[model samples]
Every structure is written in structure tokens, then in C-alpha cells.
Target: MLETGATGPSAIVLNGGSSSGKSSLALALQSELPGSWLRLGIDDFIDALPPRLVGAGGFEVEADGAVTIGPAFTALEQQWQAGVGAMARHGAHLIIEDNFVSGVAAQKRWRKALEGVTTAWIGVRCTPVVAAEREARRGDRIAGMAARQALIVHEGIEYDFTVDTTNADPTTLARSIAHRLAR
Candidate 1:
């Protein structure tokens, strides 16, 4: 079990690009971890929004392959990022999954929000080719998004650990992370 202090529960933040297997790792980690751990992600936040607002300010991929997210989506994303930290501080053992694009304001906001919590920053990595393949198979993501995000997500950040999803199975990776957390 995590050592709950004045700040509340501990957190593991999984940062990666689209199709990096963050959600799979989170599920595996939950199964391997000893105590209850809540899984939260951008999908969760997006799912919570009303249908009309879901894509209102979200990303758009142009014919030329450019991707852009509008201001309204950015604001909502920021709120969700901060809310993950708040949930941890309020006593939820959380595994937060996010594709943290570089130069985005939400990354800095997330760092600040998690300051007082017992947090581990984990990087989930995969080759762009593999990510693109996975994204294509999933069919839930915008085309070319994985390639675009692969270039920007991990910039200017350090992680306690990194898991490359390209070669390893989720269970194996989860067991490794669980062991580290147990130490």
C-alpha cells in the first residue's frame, strides 16, 4: 500500500504519445498492484463531457496532416490535468494516463499540481511505426496522430522509469513497475 501522508494518496503518472499502450499498462498495473488503484485518463475526461461539448474544442487533423486543438478543448484538458492531481491529494491511489504534448501549458500545470503528492512520472514509449500501426488497428484515433505526437510528447521531461511497449507485453511491464513500486 502507498504511504498516505498529509497530502493524501500516491500517484503514478504515465506519459506517452497516442497508441503507446498507456491504458493497457494501467490495467496490467492495477491487476499486479497490491492495493486498490484508480485508473484515470484523457479518455475518461472526454467521456464525461456531454456529446455536444466532446469535440467542440478538440483536435482537428487537416487534409495536409496538420493537427490542431482549439482553445476550448485546451481549457478543458487543463482542468482534467489538474483534477488528476486533486484526486490523488484527496486520497485516491491513481494511475494517470496522458499523452502529454510538449510546449503545451497543461504539462507545466500538471507538474505544479502534483508537487506535494508522492508521485512517480513514468514514460511509455513505442516506435512511431508501431504506434501508427496500433492506432490504425484501434481505429478510434485520428489518422497520423501517433506520428505527430511521437515527435513532441516526452520533450523536456524526465521519468522515474520508462517502458517501451513495442517489444514487451503489458503484463511483463506491469510486473516490473509493480516490483519497483513495492520497493
Candidate 2:
């Protein structure tokens, strides 16, 4: 079993692009894990933001089809990630679902904050075609977000484990992760 450090609880970080089934897998893992596991994600932080700040130029699409985040949103996201780290340090068993942009400064911040903590870095993968279909069906995501995010999220990160959400069921994947955690 993964050991919880003296200062805090261990974490399972699920990194993926938009509509890549991170949230679904997080939920399934929570349900299957024996102990209490706090399921946290980008959406949780976003939901805490003021309604006016949420969609007010938080994201921008460039002429080259790249997406950029606004400064205001970036600050908020940084704070949110810091909070996640603080929680882990204070003994919160967390499952974090994040649609991370590879090579971003925030990625480095995450690495620093979770330093010395027992962390399982999981990559949630999905084909762009499947992600797009999922996004369209959800209707809660920004247009072209999946395609844009698919280009950047997993660029240089190495995963302790990976799940292809396009083909495997979330429950089965969760069970597999749980078994690994138990070992």
C-alpha cells in the first residue's frame, strides 16, 4: 500500500485534456477505494470563482489556434492549486483531476507544492475524435477546447499509470488503479 507521509495524506493526480474522462475516473475511484478519498478537480475550483469571473475572458484563442489563459484566471488557478497542496499537507487523501497545459508555469508550481508527498501521477488519455464527441454531448465545455487541449496537456509528463478512456470503462479503470494502490 502507498504510505501516507508523516505530515499528510497521499494523492492521486489525474492529468488529462478536456473531456478526457478524468472526472468520471475520479468518481469511480472514490466509490471503489476503501477509505475516504476527496475528489477535487479544476471544476471544483472554477465553481468557487465568482460567476462574473468565470467566463469573462478567462480563455482566449489566438490566430494560430492556440489557447491562452487570462492573467486573472491564471492567478486564481494558482491559488486553487496551492490550496490542493495545503490540503494534502494537512492529511487529505485527494484525487485531483486536472486538464493541465504541458510546459506551463503552473505545472512546475504543482510539482513544487506536492514535493515530498506520496503522489501517483496518472495520465488520462483519449483520442481527439472521442474527446470531441464527448465534449459535444456534454455541451458544458467551450467549443474547440478538446482539440486545443489535446495538443498540449501530455507533452512532457511521465505517468505512473495511464488509462485510455476512449476504450476502457471508468469503473474497470478505477478498479485497476485501486488494486495498484493497495499494493
Candidate 3:
């Protein structure tokens, strides 16, 4: 069998909901892990999208905190994921944080994109109530978004391990994850 790269995981995919400390975890993981990992996430991808697709004829952040995406947004998202996976394939270390609203189907898509690339899956968990509170406190996020995604994002998708962001801070969580995965 052909050997994979010797530098450990090419990518670490962190799945979680809004306000779930995923971004925070990614930042800490960069410090904890032994690599210059490039962080590409759902929000970063969305922010880079064209304004037209951000709301009209694209993805919308609803008043109730629910998110809706159209075909255009999905198309771009697929391309974006593939691009990130390609980067990993070419030897870039990646930290990806995506909310898998479509559950296993979303994971399958990522698997297809990441073919032949070593990857680690992490489920970043937080209680809906706690996420909701964080979302409200952040003020930059839409209301109820945390509650809408907290549990839904984890459905039908399994991870190599899970981390609870309900109480543990990002640095602590990343340290724990790094130590566990390092073993």
C-alpha cells in the first residue's frame, strides 16, 4: 500500500454550530498543533462570497436565526470545499469548521473532496441553551441561531472524538484534543 504523508493529519475538520467556539478552537489548535495550519471555515467562506449570494438568491440569515441557502450558495460551497481539500492534497495543513446541517450527507461530501488526504473529524459540542446565550451576547449573530443549529449539526454525523464547549474554554479544549489525538 502507498504510504500517506508523514506529517500527521493533513486536515482537521471541526464541525459545530454558531457560537459554539469552533473559531476559537481553531485558533487555539493552531497554537497547540505542530503546524502552520490554514483555517478555512463556513463563515470565512460565506464572508468571501459575493454580496448577492449572501442574502438574495443565495444564503439568508433569517430573523428567527434560521439559515437558508439557495442553489447558488450550495454550488459555491461545494467548490469551496473542494478547493480547500485540494489545498490539503497539495500539502497544506487545514483547519475546517463547517456546520453540517445536512448531517451525514454533508460529511460524505467532505469525504469525497478529501479523498486520499489524511483528515481528522472533531465534533464541537455545546448545549443549545449555552449556545443561545453566547449568540445573544455576541450581538453580531442572529437570534436563536445557536439553538437552531446546536443539535441539528451533530445529527447523523460521527466524529473521531467530541469536545464540549459548554464550559471548557477554547485553549483548554484544544489542548485536550491535541493531547488525545497525539496519543
Each model's total of backbone clashes:
0, 0, 0
Model 2 over residues 14-74: C-alpha lDDT tens digits? 8888889999999999998877899998778777877667443674445443566677887
**Runs with alpha carbons beyond 4 Å of true place in candidate 3:** 1-6
Strongest candidate by lDDT: 3
Q: What's model 3's TM-score?
A: 0.93
- Lowest summed lDDT across 10 adjacent residues in model 3 is found at 1-10
What TM-score, computed on C-alpha atoms, does each candidate reach? Answer: 0.84, 0.85, 0.93
Lowest lDDT block of 10, candidate 1: 1-10
Ranking of predictions according to lDDT:
3, 2, 1
Candidate 3 per-residue C-alpha lDDT over 1-183 given as tens digits, one digit per residue, 9 for 90 to 100: 112255568888999999998999999999999869898899898889998888967989899988888889888888988999899989899999999876887898898888888888899999999999999899999898999999999988878889999999899999998786665
The 0-to-1 C-alpha lDDT of every candidate, in the order given, reads 0.78, 0.78, 0.87
Which is the better candidate, 1 or 3, if ranked by TM-score? Answer: 3
Candidate 2 collision pairs: none
Q: What lDDT is reached at residue 165 by model 2?
A: 91
